[model samples]
Target: MKKKHVLRLLAAAVTMGMLAGTASCGNANQKTAQENPLAEEADSAQTEQEHESAEEVDMVFRGGTVITMLSEDDTDNTAVAVKDGEIVYVGDEEGIETYISDATEVIELDGQTLMPGFIDGHIHEPGNMMTEKKELILPEGQADLDVYKKELQSFIDANPDLPIYKASGMDLQAFPDNIADNEWMDELDTDKPVVIADVSSHGNLANKIALEMAGVTKESTPPDGGKIFFDEEGELTGYLSDAVSLLSTLPIIEYTEEDFSSAMKEFQELANSYGLTAIDSGGTIYETEDPNQYEVLSNMHSAGDLTLRINTTSWAGQPLEGKESDRLIKLLDDSQKYTSDFLQICQVKFSLDGVPEGATSALLEPYTKEAGQEEGYAGTQKATEEDLTAFVTAMNAAGYSVETHAMGDASVQRSMNAFEAASEANGGTPDGVINKIAHVNLLTTEDMTRMADEGVIAAMQPLWFYYDPFFSAQEESNLGKERFEQEYHIRDMIDEGIIITGSNDYPVTADFAPLHAIEAGATQQSPYEGEDDDPAYIRNPEQSATVYEMLQMYTVNAAYGAHMDDIVGTVEEGKKADFVILGDNPLTCDVKAISDITVEYTISDGRIVYQK
Candidate 1:
């Protein structure tokens, strides 16, 4: 017998408890048919008629666990049928046979688990492509400054003909005061401009030549929501915070349409391998100056080349004042031409504050003494609350959702306030609008309730729940032990009825695996080997969520956040046939082993996109 057939028989036997009492089973079967002979005959006739009337499907999957993601209690589903890119039937193995025919392609799960294809609630899509094409991406987790210098010099030497040099992924913790200066980078190259972006992408360190090229000097004023650092002697230190406007002046690589198309295709395949069929491009749409970026995506979608559904956004620029807000609305309106089933541009993104690692995130209280701040020093906000409210109101009224980058408690509160004011202004959040606050690293209990009441979604990165080696110390110093420990109240927020979604914030987070995120969120500890053994690696255990909850964050909640809930997120009839078949059931496995689960197959639009 085939292995699949044997496994099916065994599964059936176990389900029916065939070994418990054969005589009892025979007695029950005999009683059922004999006691109600006419009823049993009617049931058989109904079954035959139903089978004859069943519509044939294109694909059928059985002999495995099916997670519908419809509810926490939905756990018994084991089969699915699909036709014309939509799920036709979702039920038990016997029910799936109704839709099967000789021509139907049957996929034997072989005791695996099938669930909705993961959705990244927040990620930078083409931004990674642009970085790969324009800059030298440094190795992640390199804490040595000398290594960066060496790598930068080597990259410059190899690409001598380039007009300028650019590198990213500099660990801020490796620098003095978590800030870089021009001296060492200037030592690498003096003739050509060189700009190095910190790992967080919230800060940048430019060499003397790059600073000069950008016309930045000691007297130059930084743009709103940005900071240009100076030394004790009042010399430009080449450190910039949230200052992309000035950096754009430097010459960089220009990628063509074909380049972007190729990069997107590669990214799609990579995402599919990770069981991702959809992603919300969180504000990286304007990262590059390429005007044809959206066009490239639209072209691909029109040509049926896109394997991933993308919810794209436009970057709501800094100083989101009245005029700027109006400009953003008009930009989004103009972008409506690109809207399609595979590509959507109905969201706008803006940062309300910087990150805590840089001691720039706006906080409600003062930073600790170790953070190098004055006794009562708090952080700063990008725009005034009035401006933020106005911007949010404009976006909401224009029939779009706003996604804010809010890290500190103050920022989160201000974002909520703005969202609330926007709702009031727009008469209840506009229909179908789902405002989001991303990177809600610090939030108060009151605000959690407020977020739930106001229907605001939290776009969170689960990987940040753990006390990872990179930013833990900085965050602790910046927020103090009490506040730091209170951060990332994922479970609390979820319990308060606030919808939370998961994301890796790709490019920002190099490791973009949902399984890794699921494990980290569940354990609230570092997923890295030998790291979780240290107690410090664990964050607030109470805030840790279950593996199934993390899955919901990546699937159903994310689909709602992206406004794709109507067609995806759950494995149900009439929904898109997007699913990932895993080697093991994450819900039933040991929490620590969740990350080790392999994606055996990824199906999108009723087509097998990946198999392993």
Candidate 2:
């Protein structure tokens, strides 16, 4: 994702001349005035008659199938009336017309189905934003490996002196030969590093420079359950993940405010393109240092340009004593209170285990494939129970919600116990604090009931089944037959009422698309119709959810996951007017057709953020 920074520079350089030319003339003011006449008029509407109806309404949406996800309790075709950014009326369209004044701007949905803006509960939104800020290395659906490599090389050839050249949309899986083998980089100038990130974002290939700059050695052991690839000769491989020792021994590249602001605009567009009216992102700026750097979502909120309602969170830095931990808690508590109808601060996130492929995830038993034979102990544990108790306890006491990463079942158990311990220490049930287990690829039955009874949210990535062989074929190879069934039990969790939300761990497994996430969760099928279906990996195909259930998970269920259930989850009156106009009703569409359906428009807080 560092590629975004470099791309932004090139973008600015190319536009520098154009900007200078425009600034030299005075026509810009006239154009701005002509474009914003209505806004000017609205601002000046203090005339006699205008004053009488000044507070009447700002806008109205008419003539569409309003699938108001007002509440999980309310169903489809729910119309809404907007006043400012909030929904003033929601229900049958009967009396809604009365709210539409002559001054109101109304849009006819043209039979399009409307629902609460799709909320993707999990996303590396900055990474997604980074992708958008970049030049198109691969056109839409042009993800073939050879073609992608050729394009990337072309980019490198075009920019000779740029020390680092990186591409984002290509897939690591697309190449038959693993990237670490160095076959791909030999053709390029290894003097300057080139890392082509996999679409999943979980792993990336580093040319010689990035590896040396990070000081990775073939003998480099991972800090946790991370994997650092090594050549057969015990030399370092270019691949890095879980083993990066991430926050610790890394050099801090100070990013400028300009970089952040530019990235924010791109990320906002990325969210809207996928019909995301709301999203919960996994990045530090969102949770810990929101004030330090204006996160794209934060900037959007401040400008009231937030087209998608966002509830983003990150975590505390290393351990701190009474003073450090306490200060962190206070910070989150103070920020979580940032109650905008558009952006809401929700939880603090922490990674308990590492990546699945890296085998950093904490599992009770050693992985079957790597087993005790491979170089290390079954992934290293980050925080001990005492440490976890202290951290979680402080967060719980501060009334801050948690979104911890625990891919392995053992790690999941540990995080859950910490939350439980924190609850017990805090005088009562902290169950409603909205702590969640993200990326629960391996959950047990007992965990299910405990989550439901304890009210812990399960923020899961449904896109996994579409990429790689997600079935236990690999884990089973290492563990056994029984281990596989524990992979994805989507229906079982819903049945247990383990409040859930679907997400695309963008730059990791899938792009952040709610429709694709839902289609994967509901049909257990890939969105690409041309590709072969995964018979081996689609675990428990019978466990797929109903259209309404999947839809709610994308809409109300996601809001509920973010603890904004009463606000923008629905298309009802008195709620935020955040919604999307779908090309086809997801609920009414054929099972497989859901993923293929496009969004015609996306309205966030009654603002037309995206229109097809």
Best candidate (score: lDDT) = 1
**Residue pairs in candidate 1 whose N, alpha carbon or C atoms collide under 3 angstroms:** none
Kindly list the per-residue Cα lDDT of model 2 for residues 1-612, writing each as its tens digit.
111100000000011111111110101121211134553464433433443443557776666677764333445444566787787654445545666777888777676777888888776656644443333345434435567667877776776655456665554334443233455666664466566544434445666666777666665655544566666666666766554453233332244556566666677787898788877766632222565543445555677755666666656544423454676666655654455655556467777776554445677766754332264346656667677778878776666677777777787788878878888888854433567778776766878788776667777776664323422233444444566555667777777767667776665543567787677677655555553264543556766777677777677667766656656665654567777888887777787788778888887777888887
TM-score of each: 0.89, 0.79
**How many pairs of residues collide in each model?**
0, 12
TM-score of 1: 0.89
Q: How does residue 126 of candidate 1 score in lDDT?
A: 58
Candidate 1 global CA lDDT score:
0.76
Candidate 1, residue 464: the lDDT equals 77
Residue 247 local lDDT, model 2: 22
Query: Which candidate wins on TM-score?
Result: 1
For model 1, state the Cα shift of residue 152 in Å.
1.1
